[model samples]
Target: MSQQAADEKLELLQHTMMNWWVQEHFDYPWRDSSEPDWKRLITEVLLQRTNAAAVKRLYVDFFFKYPTAESLASAPVEEVEQAIHSLGLRWRAQYLPGLASNIADGVPDSSDELMKLPGVGPYVTGAFMVLHRNTSSTFVDANVVRLLGRYLGFEWDGETRRKKWLLDHVDALFSHGYTPSEFGYALLDFSREVCGRAPQCQSCEARTQCAYFATLEANNRALAQDNS
Candidate 1:
């Protein structure tokens, strides 16, 4: 695609994404700007390979019991495990205290130092940067990678989200009209809602413009002709 065409598509995506977020995005406590950095970071950890709805159900109560990183850090591993047992991944409960211990010192100002902490990785760091730090970064998880890869029609040999081309593309998209947090959240929600592993391509709002949808439609048409 030419530079001009890519810019136009990005603009349209930003407009469409922000609109969807305004109307359809799920509300999460961690997305709240007023939430403390520790809570936000912990929420990200909890969200990994766990459903957002499950996290939502226990978030307030979990935080109320612990309140701060220092409090969580001091809590027994067994207690922490029981606290988040409903979220599953019982093994993850063991790491909570160590993660909290690291954050009890304070959420590190530098991304490098922050990632050194337990359970903090690119997705978590990116979320912190865009949502809390008000910086431009792309928060990529499976949902995000699926969404962007399908919409933009990109391929990578390994870890699509971590690849420079994908990250740069997402960062560029976020640096434009929409705030990264808004766009990032929209990507996450939309991917889950409309563009899942078995995407609802026909019903998706961006069907006409989405590369994946177009490809699917074309394949369907060819199949129909062959059958006929």
Candidate 2:
């Protein structure tokens, strides 16, 4: 398909995605803007490398005590671990309070600045800025990796090339159609339910234009023809 056609299709897909998710999106407290920034940051942290379901209970309880950065900062290291026991990352959990101190307030703008805090990295920094800032920053999680991987049908595994391609798509999508927060949520929902770990190709709305699906279908046809 031509770039114009693909861009139009992408816009349509983005709209459909928001409609579906607004009705069905998971109701997590972190999603509530009324929730404190500290709470949101904590949720985002616990959410790193952890499933949402698993983080739910822990997030609620953790915020009860260390409600803000100051409280978290003053709280002992062992206390942080004790509260976040179920989170399964004792070491990283301990560092978040210190990280919060460094951030000073909400998520920092520069990735380098965010990284200066404990437990922050390029991936986490990108995620924070995009979801929180609405700055059209590109984000990549495993969901993004798989989403673009299947759709774009990347031939080369060059990490730089791969990252750039995905970032460009994300930037475009955020720029044209979606809010940073909602778009991130939609992408997360799509990746989990539609695209999935093994991928349920049949349920995907975007499958018609999905490079992975298209490539898979083409390959099947070729194989069938060869067998015949």
Candidate 3:
């Protein structure tokens, strides 16, 4: 497709995805926009590579015990490990306290500085920077990647160029109004419920504009005609 055509298609996709997210994004304890920076960081640290359902079960008590960066910073490494024992990566939990402590002291102004921490990676650090500060930078976690894959009608064998292209599209689409946080959460929800691992094309809200769902439906109809 031409560049203009591709841009128009992506805009339509964004609008469709936004509506579903407005209604259905998960309301988790750690998702509160009002929460302090350290608190959010703690949740993200614990959530990394762990299941969301399992995190919901443990988040409250874990937060209650180690509520603040200062609290976790002073907390024993063993105690932090015990708190997030179910999430796995006990080593991550151990380093989390120190990371939180630095945030408590001073949240990093630059993405580069944020990535300098022990537990911070490109995705994790970028996510926190956008979510907390509402930066213009677009994010793509596992969920966003899945959503983009399905939306773009690709099997998505996890290629770097593919990921970059989608991220570039996101940046262009959200160049003005939408915050990166909102777009991130929307993609996260759409990937999980609407677009899904096994996409529900029939009931989906974005079937018209969704690259994957539209192609799938067209294929099904063609198959039916051939059988007829």
TM-score of every candidate: 0.83, 0.77, 0.83
Q: Per-residue lDDT for 5 in model 2?
A: 49
* Candidate ordering by TM-score (highest first): 3, 1, 2
lDDT of 1 at 136: 73
Worst lDDT run of 10 residues, candidate 1, spans: 1-10
CA lDDT of each prediction against the hidden true structure = 0.77, 0.69, 0.72
- For model 2 the local lDDT of residue 152 reads 56
Q: Point to the candidate with the largest lDDT.
A: 1
1-228 per-residue lDDT for model 1 (tens digits): 544455566666666666776788577888887888888888888987688889999998999999989999989999999999999987878878899888776687777787888777777787777777767766777777777677777654447777766766676567676666677777777767777778877656666677887888899999999999
Can you write out model 3's per-residue Cα lDDT over 95-164, one digit (the tens) per residue?
8778877888667767888788778877677677777677866555666666655665556555642465
- Which sections of candidate 1 miss by over 4 Å? 1-8, 155-158, 226-228
Off by over 4 Å in 3: 1-4, 89-91, 159-163, 173-176
Model with the higher lDDT, candidate 1 or 2:
1
- Please list all clashing residue pairs in model 2, or write none if there are none: none
How do these models rank on lDDT, best leading? 1, 3, 2
* Per-model root-mean-square deviation over C-alphas: 2.9, 3.6, 2.7
